[model samples]
Target: MTEIRHYKIGEDRFKISEDEVARRELKVTKVADDVIQIQEEIHGIIALVGATSTVNIKKDELKELIKIVREEFGWTDIC
Candidate 1:
């Protein structure tokens, strides 16, 4: 079974998972914008890891990998 996780970005809350479920609705706030920035930072870290690795992964794959890592590390409150 695929696990589902929800996140709130700038006025744009969404859920991600290995499954194909639609995201839940969320409210937008200044904090949400900040969350988006942190998410970008997470993506940056993933990009860096990809750059340093021998594997030639695409940006989308890197993003998915990052999400998995974050979930494993219990980094739900990254921002």
Candidate 2:
């Protein structure tokens, strides 16, 4: 089994695991600013695929997903 951890960057929080950290071709370093940087491998692949097949999720939807994950893990707000 793999263990995942969630951390709040400023006010928002997200779940990420050790495996994900290692495998992520794109990094969401500063979520608050919505600034994401993709690695060369990911960039090359994305360039070929293009950004046409994308789903735009609302902020509320993302918040709900985060809430569900947090609740499932019995996480508490320490901050």
Candidate 3:
């Protein structure tokens, strides 16, 4: 599978995603699940779109998903 890459240019950040899903909601929402919704703003209609607001995941599955998200966006627990 192809992976998206993140980079820094001066004070700016950027991402190049070959994966279609990565470009849709994932960039704005991600695992934080904290994207503010403006009144009347419509959600994107894309692949993997779901009607439910939440999903039940196994502990191990969540852990692994988090690790991937962190690494994908160059996030770390340390400053």
Task: Please name the candidate that would achieve the greatest TM-score relative to the true structure.
Answer: 3
Tell me, by lDDT, which candidate is best: 1
TM-score of 1: 0.26
Residues 1-79 of candidate 1 have per-residue lDDT tens digits of 4443444332222334454333222211223322322232122112243344232334554565456445643456553
Q: Which has the better TM-score: candidate 1, or candidate 2?
A: 1
Tens-digit lDDT track of model 3 for 43-69: 332445567564334455446445644
Off by over 4 Å in 3: 1-52
Candidate 1, residue 67: lDDT: 68
TM-scores for every predicted model: 0.26, 0.25, 0.31
Task: Tell me the tens digit of each residue's lDDT in model 2 across 1-79.
Answer: 4444333312222335443322112211222222222222222122255555443345654564456434544435512
For model 1, the superposed segments whose C-alpha errors exceed 4 Å read: 1-53, 75-79
lDDT of 2: 0.34
Higher-lDDT candidate of 1 and 3: 1
| Deviation in Å, model 1, residue 17 alpha carbon | 35
Residue 38: error of model 1 in Å?
23
Which residue pairs show backbone clashes in model 1?
A: none
